[model samples]
Target: MIDSAVALPQGRRQRNKARVQERLFEAAVELIARHGYDNTSIDEIAARADVARGTFFNYYPRKDDLISEWSARRGTELRRSLVTEAGGLEPGDTVSRFHRCLAALVELNEDRQEVNRSMVTAAVRAGCLGARESATAELFTAILTDGQARGEIGEGLDPDRLGLLLRDAYLGVLTRWAVGAEQDHASLYRELHEVFKVFLIGALPRTAHRDCCPHTA
Candidate 1:
């Protein structure tokens, strides 16, 4: 979902540039998502975007730039879902809110063997994963802080520190998925729900109902 409204460009020329840039980036991700990243070259990305091969360089100096952009967008997706509330914010169960946030995350990661592997390789090589992790961790901290206020989350928990750990746990499962170790669960969503159980053990108040976990999310 579009997280926010974008300001219109002042000039027609600037708008055209923005459109071309978006088209190129969208084309690149679609191509990489379909074919393996390594197998998809600059030529293919440019052709798919309907731009000249040289024009691709005009927007992205190197192919890795596109990957870095994609990684940033992935991080933004988390914030968009949680902070902005794609539809509209409605107060509810903190646990359920967090579950939905995580479910959105799970939906973002592809299960396709070649595509995910290639995307992981590109993300790692681009060196943007750490930034993504940090941004996502901050969002986690925000959620935990809110949950604590609502008396749903455990007290005495360090939201900032725990947020970083949550980020680690999130990536840990993602790493497993990336490595094709998600075979235990029938599907990726199920796999994440399984892993999230461990987090709830520490996150929820001791008095919180064990049945509060939403497995269907």
Candidate 2:
């Protein structure tokens, strides 16, 4: 059975709630950036946002929720960019498509360097700030699976392991860039692309010396 009774003020209250939530999220980001994750408190965020402490609780059960929300939003944006960029690439173009995706991700991070640095620092410290890590890994796995099915990526490469490797490498590079590294982003990406091309495509000469199980590249 469903209750169809309506409250006249329900709609208005919902709108108000949304507005308060937005304010709380904004306040939390600012406070976290200023005070670091361990020191930032819900009461501080509420006061900074000019909302009551109860309002803060209504939006985020805890301070970490704010970080999780932010990470999820950024992950969604990255996934969208990857999908849109890879839309029409041929199977043979998988390597190029992946390079473009990596470049796009670097550019996106460059645009949000400060927030990214802060988030990475917090996540590294707290270990699990981003709930979307698994989702991002899944996205990589799908991309690799498609490439492999089409004969673009090499056979016998475990999609899950490859995905995890790529995520670690990408995050490691971004982490370095975030910490005031002056390396040229494009050059670094090109080098990595070359490595990936040789490793995944087996384009290197048979006689070329190579260690087994090189995760990078």
Give all TM-scores, in the order shown. 0.72, 0.72
Error of 1 at 216 (Å): 35
Candidate 2 lDDT by residue in tens digits, 85-152: 54533333666667666666666666645566677667655665233355556667777888888887
For model 1, the superposed segments whose C-alpha errors exceed 4 Å read: 1-4, 85-90, 110-117, 181-186, 202-217
Model 1: per-residue lDDT, tens digit, 1-217? Answer: 5322455434788778889999998788778777767778999989989999999999999888876676667777766766654543336577787788767786667534445556776665566445535667777787788888889788967888878777777766666666674465446677667666778775567778656766734
| Every candidate's CA RMSD | 6.9, 6.3
Worst 10-residue lDDT window for candidate 2 reads: 1-10
Question: How does each model score on lDDT?
Answer: 0.72, 0.67
User: Per-residue error at 124 for model 2, in Å?
Assistant: 2.0
